[model samples]
Target: MSVEVNNETDYEVDLHDVQKLADSITEAMFIHPETEVSIVFIDEDAMSELHVEWMDLEGPTDVMSFPMDELRPGSETAPSESGILGDIVICPTIAEAQAKAGGHAVHDEILLLTTHGMLHLMGFDHEEPEEKAEMFTLQRRLLEGYTGRPAPKETVE
Candidate 1:
């Protein structure tokens, strides 16, 4: 899988570490090796604009996903269909505040947001109670092994 990370903001993010974690998550989720995914980091103004334009929300959000091909996770024996997975837009400023409030490192918060955005790219949503349960469960499971945090809380974008 090709995990492309672009930091468009002024904040100092570990792009290399973010890419590594994104690649690992995509691999663990069984995304096709040929599929391409982009992770973009933006500032509050940009995020606010996108939030209003795309989601019609009022404020800047943590993360937003724009799925290109609607790809799903594949099995070990069968790779997922090859296509552009999607673009995950993250706001570092918002994430930093969320991390501070959640008592976790900002990087871990970004990882959680990234994973959550990826799951959205894979057609996951928390609009309903059941959907929220399933998506959050999977998200926590995916992060716990890496962040050593047993329970990861949910945040909206």
Candidate 2:
């Protein structure tokens, strides 16, 4: 899978690790190897602007997904079509505060959000209770499977 991670923020994150997690998820979910997905790390200001522009919200959210092709999950025999899976934009500043409150590493929280955003890209919604359960259950499963392996570490630049 062509998972491109672009760190536009000053936060010290392991770009490769995030990309690997995304790649693993897409591969496991049967997304085509030619499909393109971008994970972008941005500052709070940029995120907030996007939040307002796209979602018409007030403040910066942890993550936001902008899907392009509306791709759905496919089976092993028939993978999803190759196309732009869209962008998952995350704000590290917001993530850090959430991690502190959740008592987990920032990277782990980011991974959770990444998976959450991925689910959204795959047309999973949580506006309703049933949708919430299904999406969250899958999210938890994906995160659990990924955490079993050693996730990438943050590097100080």
TM-score of structure candidate 2: 0.93
| Candidate 1: tens digits of C-alpha lDDT, residues 41-102 | 99999999999999899999999999999999888988789999999999999999998888
**TM-score of candidate 1 against the unseen true structure:** 0.94
Best by lDDT: 1
lDDT of each: 0.87, 0.86
* Residue 19, model 1, lDDT: 82
Please give the range of 10 consecutive residues that has the lowest summed lDDT in model 1. 148-157
TM-score of each model, in listed order: 0.94, 0.93
Q: In candidate 1, which residue pairs get closer than 3 Å at backbone N, Cα or C atoms, i.e. clash? A: 1-33
Give lDDT tens digits, candidate 2, residues 1-32: 88899999889988888898899889889999
Give the runs in model 1 whose Cα sits over 4 Å from its true position. 148-151
Candidate 2 all-Cα RMSD:
4.7
Clashing pairs in 2: none
Clashes of each: 1, 0
